[model samples]
Target: MESTREPAAPIAELDEDAAQLAALGYDYDTTFKRDMTFWGNVALGFTYLSPVVAVYTMFSVSLGQAGPPMFWSLAIAGLGQFFVALVFGEIVSNYPVAGGVYPWSRRLWGRKWAWMNGWVYIVAMFATIASVSYGAGPFLGTLFDAEAGVNTTVVCALVMLALALFFNLSGTRILNTAAMVGLICELGGAVVVGAWLLITARQHDVSVLFDAFGAGDGKSYFIAFSAAALIGIFQYYGFEACGDVAEEIKNPGRQIPKAMRWTIYIGGFAAMFIAFALILAVPNYEAVVADFNAGSTNDPLTMVLISAFGPIGYKFVVAIVLISFLSCLISLQAAVSRLTYSMSRDGILPFSKKLVRVNERTGVPSTALILAAVVPASIILLSLLLPDALVTIISFSSVGIYIAFQMVVLAALRARILGWKPAGSFRLRGWAFPVNILALAWGIIGITAIAWPRTPEAPWYVNYIVLLTALGVLGVGALYMWLKKPYLVGSAPSGDATSQINTIAARPREQVSR
Candidate 1:
């Protein structure tokens, strides 16, 4: 007869004796690895492209109508994200885990509040996945313009979500591998394209960057650019993804915190450089604007490339754009799954047990992956049934994610200002704290600006959807608080170590019955 015993985990040991001693009948033993390197952490942080997102959102809206100082808006948003990253770094230093912001908020606040944070965090997370998929679908379809079919867009969205889910469920090793590859592709692609643009730019066109005079329309540059800044926030969202994997990170208390700091500066600067280079390299601002206004989904960057470097350069930009979208998709998947797992482990949602399950072979939160993919897939399918439904939902997603981000930053600031200091960790000395406080303020301002009604002519449905999504998130938080009351109020240790123990116990079991 074939052996019934499964192979043991190479990097971990089963604490069967201890389990027996405690009379616990948990399925799996304590077995996992967390040795991610500095570079790996960098890869994880860089996989979320601020520049691509910044460009996409900036061009999508009428930011130029408001003013030409759009870059300043990006600068403001980047600065805001930078401060939030510092606050996050402090928290990660002391209690690094995959939960990232929500868990940190919980630790600083309390279990009940953490569950509320998780409700908002997870809802907003899946909403983000839907938004990205929705946003990318239109762009990608535009790339295929004349031949783009409705069925094609739907199919592509589903496929991308499925593949992302596979990468997520394949476990930590595959996730890290994908992160490294995606990061290289994204960083290298940005640098190469930016370099090409700079090398070939005529000095006259480059002069446009340093002009102090605003585009001087009726709109103030700050407000118009603030619209663009909304897009800028996209680029930095994934940098903290490494923090989500903190428990799986080697020496996370030190390395994860350092990774967060490094990610903020590097990701922020790189994104700014890309934006500057692309703007400078564009030979024809009129052409770039015309293409964007014409709704060409080939990427505004591709339009810039074609205008500057001809057909070949345009093709190169096209490839880079696709890679950028792919990297964003990968980073989003990892973040959503890890967050779902974290929330589940805390019993903040339904299917808590299932969502927290780690596959024996993969050591991934498989059920969480399924949930992430399914939710987005359903949203996409619903889009098919309702023509402009996905668009509204995508917009709602931005509102949700931005609000959640604001809360996390505010919570971090509250902790710091209330005399909570990071213990034995990487403190951002030398104006970092002051900068962080400013960033928090800017974050709040930006979110409020984006949420505000920009035009009287703007559709009424947008207002309704945004309002409804906010209420829904809050409602879920209330529901979770009621259901998970015991877990939050039980006075158990609520940090990485305890969570890790629960995660270990939740794994698949293969015991020696004798």
Candidate 2:
């Protein structure tokens, strides 16, 4: 007698007919031409830095005690990210799709465990959208020096979300152009600011850059800096947004990997400069810290600029900060919509095809874009009632992205280690194995460090949120397996839809526990 369990879908090279079918709900018409030049790619790098978010996180937390170690923490996180970026560079070259990590991991590990990768990524994206959009309001409000318009920020985020949705739904051309513009307006300014800091630091008391001052937490200098690294690291993580737009990029297998590697190195270095400049310019360290902690409107960079280069410099930094925030808002919206489109196309989400439908003329994911706007809007509304919830949500969301990164990195490493190389349009050579292993170790350490309580000065809830979010992802993945498995069986709508979904749709189940 044969056992009753259904056989899994066989992994095979997709032929023409199957490929066409998979492309149906994939918003192919909206696909942008692969016209991205190296400069456009560089602009994409700056967009990920999103200086506004970086400045906001550092000033708010660093004010408490961390000071310049904040910049050092960023460097440490960048080292870990280097490995993760390498892993991404390799996998994305082979499997470049909007779904990104989840699909790559599942394929590497076998479908039995793949769902775990996709589900965690989906939840993580949702949380990230919530957190970043929420944080946007305060940063903008700080620049304006006004009470944050709960409605205004929410509305603004929603509008930004809508614009991103439309652009993505419209086509790759628009998204690429917008991303390029964002890189210029925001990232260019950040590089300048970072440069200014480095140039001016030598003149001021340069020791502040080396000062291991504590914010009264009593943690070792290394630990404090590591915690600070979390804040800085947040700025760099979204560079993988390039991977999510793979379908729109021409020869994505080559370009996506190239984009990821370049973005990390360039963006990471750029952030380091901006951070150092901000820290060093503020020779009155206590006052800078005080202003940062006192309220949301503390513009430390502005203050530092005034001290170093006078009022003219302050105005320039302020202009750059505003532009940077605007660019970030745009990029965040783009990331959210594409992620949604990728998930919906996979039938892992409801109305998969319809939700991800692209407007042929505009080359955007119309429905998914609309829905993405709703999430940020809702988050903005939540901020009205709960002002403090913004950063907490963003911090929580960062953990989810890290987990997704880890899973993707592990899957890529496993494949390379197990002699399972799939030829793609682009490739990473030689050190893939060693670099990936190092990346995995760094990711584990960073995740564990972020999960632990960094300061007793803060409430216990910070650590609890991290734990709960982790458990929540685990429980949600299990729940999908138990309740939604039937809907996802081979050759069914979900199964077929899975082919059209982004590469990161289904994660391998085993990896979650690991």
**How does each model score on lDDT?**
0.61, 0.60
lDDT of 1 by residue, 1-514 (tens): 1111234333234343333211222222333346457777877777654356446544434333322345565676666777777767766665555667666766666666666666776776786676666656645665555356667777766776777777776667877787777766667776776777777764335456544233323455554454455556555566677788765665565676677767777667767776777666545555444544455544555456677768765655665666566666777777777777666665665767777776767766677778888888887787776545544564566666666666766666666666655552466656656866776676667556656554445477554555676787788678656765734542324532222233232122233112
In angstroms, how far off is 465's CA in candidate 2? 1.3
* Candidate 2 lDDT over residue span 145-200, tens digit each: 65655665665555444554555454556656767777766667767766766686
Go through the candidates in order and give the C-alpha RMSD of each one to the true structure.
6.8, 7.9
- Best model per lDDT: 1
After superposition, the stretches of candidate 1 with alpha carbons farther than 4 Å from their true spots are 1-31, 53-67, 138-146, 149-151, 201-207, 210-221, 283-300, 308-313, 383-395, 416-419, 428-436, 461-468, 479-514
Query: What count of clashes does model 2 give?
Result: 25
